[model samples]
Target: MGPTRKRDLAAAVVAAAVLGYLLVRATYRYFPPITVWTGMSLLGVAIGLAGWGFYVRARIRDAEIGVGRGRLHPLAVARSVLIAKASAWMGAVVLGWWLAVSAYVLPRRGTLRVAAADSPGAMIAGLCALALVVAALWLQHCCRSPDDAPPDADPAPG
Candidate 1:
């Protein structure tokens, strides 16, 4: 499969943020309050993926250097790449969702139970999602072939 595209990721974030903002503006009152667990949950997933991705990247790099039994299994690399891409996309959605929620709540600070109760959680969730994006992108970079990657693509960290 092809690598994730920046434009595609950007589109996902922008579209989701816009839609999230609109959704909250139109229906937050009717919707249930946002929970702190939402952020915590996303954070947990993000951390797990980052750890796994780093492990995969190290193994792949080791194989490339003939430091292991052989090259990594093709399917494993493929699957890892797919997961990395999806993780980034998920990060975009999560960030957008919480960012919109936070924005909506900031203005209505004194007016809504959900907004007041959830604003802090929403902000933290957005930040965690941003971290997820970074980790996902780092994983994608790590999985690249030194000779195959384009000049603009990231190189493996030292």
Candidate 2:
């Protein structure tokens, strides 16, 4: 599979940020409190994907070197690539989302919504989103051809 396109991720982030900003602006009438659970969910998804990517990468490496009875299925690798792509795009959107939210919440702390909003959770989610980007890249690195990888006996994805 081809590498995840930077343009697509950037576009998604921009779109999500604009939408998020507009959403928060429009919802000012209702002024709902931002839930921490959403942020925690984002963190959970990122960590889960990263963990799964590591498992796939290890299996692929073992298969490539003809170690053990682990057989690397082409479909599994394809799925991993898809997951990486999705993670990259999702991370960008979430990062931009929380950024917009933070921008809105920062100067308006006196309001009930701003005071109650979990800005710290949003920030934590943003950091997790960043982690997902690195994880996606690492997963892509793991999917490279053996020829593309180094010739070392114990090679690692760069």
Candidate 3:
């Protein structure tokens, strides 16, 4: 891999690690009394890790084919996008199902004691988690190297 590609990959790893930590902390704060929240957080972590795994796998393939020495190839970009889309879809479906189930289960079990749905802390934490997922998806789609540009493009005049 070239210096630039190596740098980009390293930066991505660092950013993901930091974001993952923040997401975990926010999840803990949002659902302090529920084990379900921990499960959700773990799911998020797994999704993130899966995405990263895809990324590294793509990178390795690119390197093997001499594509990594240049900019990211279209195939690598496509792989990352697919992984991100899968992760986002999975997270959304699982989270939605959990929320729906909790709505009924909690009330039926007489465990809905907290009456602060409108509480600022809870709202903020929820929003932060949502934002984290959105950001992860965006990052997965947006961070491709310049070499991954579409073919049949005209070179700009110098």
Candidate with best lDDT: 1
lDDT of 2: 0.73
**lDDT by candidate, in order shown:** 0.80, 0.73, 0.47
TM-score pick, better of 2 and 3: 2
Q: Which segments of model 2 are wrong by more than 4 Å?
A: 29-31, 110-113, 149-158
lDDT of 3 at 26: 49
Better of 1 and 2 by TM-score: 1
Residues 20-126, model 2: lDDT tens digits: 98997777557556666656766677677778777777887787798966866878778888888878887898878887777667667667455446576566767
- TM-score of each candidate structure, all chains considered together: 0.84, 0.77, 0.38
Per-residue lDDT of model 3, residues 1-158, tens digit only: 11123234335444544555455434534644433243446345655755665565566566657876544566766666665555555444444333433333334344334423323333333333444445445546454553555344567846
- Residue 35, model 2, lDDT: 63
In the range 47-116, model 1's lDDT, one tens digit per residue, is: 8777877777778777778896666677877777888898999999878887888889988879866678
Candidate rank order under lDDT: 1, 2, 3
Which pairs clash in model 3?
A: none
